[model samples]
Structures are given as C-alpha cells and as structure tokens.
Target: MDLREKERKTVEILRALKKVNYPGYSRDIVSFGFLKKIEVYDDDRVFIDLEISTQKEEVIEQIKEKVQEEIGKIGWIKGLELSVREREIFRRQKIPIKGKTVAIYSTKGGVGKSSIATQLAYTFSVLGLKSSLLDLDVYGPSIPKMTGTQDSEPTSYDGQHIIPVEKEGVRIMSLGYMAKGDTPVIWRGPLVIKAFRTLIFSTHWPDTDVLVIDLPPGSGDIQLSLAQEVNIDGIVMVTTPQDIALEDVRRGISMYRKLEVPILGIVENMSWFTCDSCGKKHFIFGKGGGELLSKVYNMELLGQIPFDYELLELADRGKIYVLEKKNSEVAQAFLSIAKKIIDLLKISV
Candidate 1:
C-alpha cells in the first residue's frame, strides 16, 4: 500500500483533532474533555464519539463541522462516523413511565421494525403484564394504524399530562394519533426534536412492567436525544436477513454503544417463509445475517422471525398477528423473542 493510503492510528487522529476548537470557545474540545472515544476499526474507518456538556444545536453543529473538516484532512481516511452526544442543558423532568424501557431500533426503514415492536408490546400484555408502546418514529408513525387507534385522540383531564390510548391491555401513544387521518409529519429538525421531547415528557405514562419504544429509523438527533434524556434499560435491534439491512444495523449498534445504551439482543425479521403446500422453509432474504451479526457483536440471537405473507394484510388492517395466529411459527417467533427480552432485562412480567 502507498504511504499516504496507510491506515490512520488513534494517536494520528488525536494529533489532527488538536486543531478543532469548540464553537465560540478558544479551547479545543479534546482539552475540554468532550472526546470520549476515538476508534479506528474495520477497513481503516474511524468512529469518533464526543460527549459535550451543552444542548445548543448551533454549538453541536459547529463542533461537528469543524471536526469533520479537520478529520477529512487525513488523506487516507476511507470512512468517518462522528457521534456528538449533547447533555441536557438543564436538569429536565424525567418521563412518567415506570420500570424498564426496551427500545426497538433500526437505522433503515421498512424492515418490519414497527411490526416487531407492536407484537412485542402485545405479547407482554398477553403474559398478564402492564405494557406500554411509544412510537418515536416521527416521520412515519405507524403505531396508531397498527394498533387501530387512528380514530382516537389523546385526552387529558389535568391538561398537563396527556393520556395514552389503550388497546388489548397495552397503553400506546404516537404522533399518528394527532394527525388528521393518514396525514404525514413534515416538520423540520428543530420542530421534530421538540415533538419528541413533548411526547416523552407530556404523556402520563402509567406504571408498567415494561415500555417498548419504536425508535425512528437512523442514528440521528432523535436517538441521541432520547438516550441522553431517558433511562433505556436495553435495546432490541431489528433487521432483515439481508446484507443491505445488516449494514445499517451495524451503524445503529455503534451509536447506541457509544451512548452506553445496553444492547439486549437482535431480532432478525423476515428470515424465512414456510410454504404451506410444500412444508419447506425457504430463505427469502438470504440466510444467517442475524446470526452473523450476533456472533460478530457478541449479542444474543434473540430470534429469527419468519415472513408470514398474511401478516402484511393483517397488520395493514390493524389486526394483531400474534393474537390472530397464536399457534403460528411467526407468532411463536415474536412471543419467544418477548420472553427472551424479559429474561435478559430481568423485567417483572
């Protein structure tokens, strides 16, 4: 390899980082003790994790811009991922939910992420446990449609605390419930952040055994903000049994790990399809992506959920799949995963 194309070391990155000063501050972010990690891994890529003591958007962006520009100066840098986790400027009030919070996350969308989250919450309820589901997928809030709560609006007698809609013993809340019948949420970043804060702080979440949050797709402001604000017990990573989906899952895992968020396990969705007539399991989206990730990351292979062709129609029509076919292989996959989650997190159910 050419000398210029040689892999950069942590010390080398640190040397380059000395030039990056915090926004409106003379001292470098490293000297100010904001740099938490500088990892150079996988194909000469760099993962920089910064933990700052401010929530100001402009400051964060300024630091980000300056750092990226400085890091780009390294000619051989094949890839760069920078995560800036901002601390709450003020000691804010915690959300009303009690007990453990198990977040379901995916960096890429349409991996049946939301569906898995819904079924997990439902399964918790079926096991005679108080369960709540929070849909943090702001841009595409599918919880209301999945739970058959679109016609209902959240109500609050006290005006300060909003009541979550209940269905099949599971308490639920989503931005979709506020929209006017299938309307899209088209807000910009600042407003989207505010909306996330409002839902978490405003809702009068009842005491429950566990709360499952369907995090918005991506390792962005939403995920960072929630991690900084809420006490997430652990996260269940959802991904399809395909390379495309697995790539995004890796990035998401890195972000959560940097935030010190516990990874409960991984759920491989649409892993296979069982042909009714042939009675054979066919791998629709390639095989063993989930197991590969689990082995690589040392995370448990929670379960591989099969593709039930009927699930698309059932979920679209607001019918719970687990409840519809309790004896089904797919349904069993969901229930089995739920049990593992409770056991892993040690949540009372």
Candidate 2:
C-alpha cells in the first residue's frame, strides 16, 4: 500500500470499529471515545489502539473480540492487532450503608426474583433486624410497585445524597419510584453504572443489618459492574424449577464465584402446585431442579416456594405477601430462606 493509500486505509480501519460496540452496551466503542489510534501497515496489516474506562477483564476481551470480528471481514487485510488500555473510571467508594449486602440474582428473567427479594427484606424486618432493600435493577425496578411506594420519590436533603423511601419497616430505594408507570430505562452501560453510583454510593441508607439488592436477571454489564464496585457479601441464586432456569442459574453461580462473592444458596420459586380435591403436590415447572443444582454444585438449596397465585395478587396490590399470609406455605418458605440467608450472611439481629 502507498503512503496516501495507507492513510486512507487507516481511516477505513478506524471507521470500521464504529460497528464494534462495548461489551454490553448499544453504543459503539468509537463513540465511547475508546479508539485512540489506528495504523495501516505496508503489508496490508493493521494495528488499533483503544483506551476504555472499564476495568473488567472479560469486558476487555469482549471489546477486542468484537473489534477483531468487525475488522477481519476486509479481504485486503492480512493481519489485525488490537490493544485496549483500561482507564480508571472512578475511585472506589463505600455504599454509605452499614449492612451485609445480599443480592437476589438470576441468569434468566421472570422467575419472581423481585418478589422474593422484597419478601426476604420484610422477613428480616419481622425477625427484628433493621433491613434495607435497594432495588438496583435500573431497567425494570419492580420494588416500588411491589412495596406500593411507586408514587413516592426519595428525598435528597443534599443535591448529591438521596434519602431512601421506607415501606413496611424496610428502607427502600429504586429508580422506579421516580419514573412513571412501566417506563423503560433506555440507558447505556456507563449510564447504568452512573445510576448505581447515585443510588448506591450517593444515597443515604439508614443503619441496617441486611441490604437486599434485587438485581436484574442476567450476568451482564450491570451485574459485573455492581460486583466490582460494591462489596457484595453474598448472593442468593433464584430460579424456577426448570432445566432452562437451572442452566441460567448455573452460569450465574460461576460468575459470582469468579467475582469471589459468597453463594448463600438457591431458592426455587413456583416449585409445585397443590391439587384442590386430591391435595397432592404436583411439580409444575419440574421436580427437584433446585435440589439437583444444589447437589451438582454442592451448594445448599435454601427453600422451594410453591406456586402461590395469592402471592401474585399480593404483589399486584403492593402488599407484602409474607406479612399478609404469614401462615401460608409460600410465606413460610420465604421466611425459611431468609433465615438461611441471615445465618449465611452472619447478620445478628
């Protein structure tokens, strides 16, 4: 390639990276201002330099993979080299809360993770331990709706620090409280992390024993970012009694384990249904997926919640299911799991 041709080729290669998005965001890496320089060599080879604010190793690899995939399609290129420099995004800070953080996480969605989290926090409160629930799922924060605090916005005494909204004796905070009903959060990964900083690092949570974080379903950027920034003391894997959910939970377990977060065990939601006439237990999703996962991973199965339609009704009315049905089987299951989590987290009431 001649000098002028090389310059044009360098521009082409650099422009090509616009298709390569950051690991878990819709925005391209080029727009993220990560592409520092590109050099097209005489032998139809190219070298690209990227400086990104993410410190995650897997994310770095993902960006490189995407860049290579996008740049490798050109027939004229003989080779491609990429270098990604991890720029420090921000200094690590404490969550400004005194508690053991227990995250309710899943690799799959719609398994009642938020319901369980809200119930768990209530259980802790019932057990006489001050509990706080931070609904960290910015995309679809269901805590406000479940707790019936959707209309109440958290008060920020200072512009930088927000005071959390309290409900059912459990201090609560979520982005859902501010947004209108079912409004989608259309933010990129960095914006999501910025929300985390504001909600977590900037919010003023009352002194409590347990902070239940209802994480959105997945092992993606949101999960990874929180794990990296906050000291997640334990994680409770939630899943339905099905192969697919168990499979997702398996991947979630691996991710948390890699992050060195303690696994508090698993909760099997919608495990079974009771026959009205025969009174026989019928496995709805599947029997013993939680138990099977426990045995396979050598992780304890915390509790299995039966298919409770009333619980759904309770949530829809913004009522705490455990408080409403304290004597119900599903309520007892939630309490059981909460007790196990308390013991696992070593939270003294």
Predicted model with the maximum lDDT:
1
The true-versus-predicted C-alpha distance at residue 92 of model 2, in Å, is 5.6
- Go through the candidates in order and give each one's C-alpha lDDT: 0.83, 0.82
Per-model RMSD to reference: 5.7, 13.0
What clash count does candidate 1 reach?
0
**Error in Å for residue 29 of model 1:** 16
lDDT of 1: 0.83
List residue ranges in candidate 2 displaced over 4 A: 1-93, 245-247
Superposition TM-score, candidate 1 onto the true structure: 0.77
Question: On residues 1-349, what C-alpha lDDT tens digit does candidate 1 reach at each position?
Answer: 3233333377789987878988777889999998887766546778888888986988899889989999999876799988887863534345676778889987787888789989999988888779899999888899888877878889998988889898888889898888655567877789889989878888787687888899878888888888777778889888788875545677778767876779999899999999999999999789888887786566999999999877888888888888888899988888888899889888876
Error of 2 at 99 (Å): 1.9
The segments of candidate 1 whose C-alpha lies over 4 angstroms from its true place after superposition are 1-93, 245-247
TM per candidate comes to: 0.77, 0.73
lDDT of 2 by residue, 5-116 (tens): 8778877887789988887789998898877667565567676778788769899988888888878877799987667768745344556678788989888889889999
**Best candidate, TM-score-wise?**
1
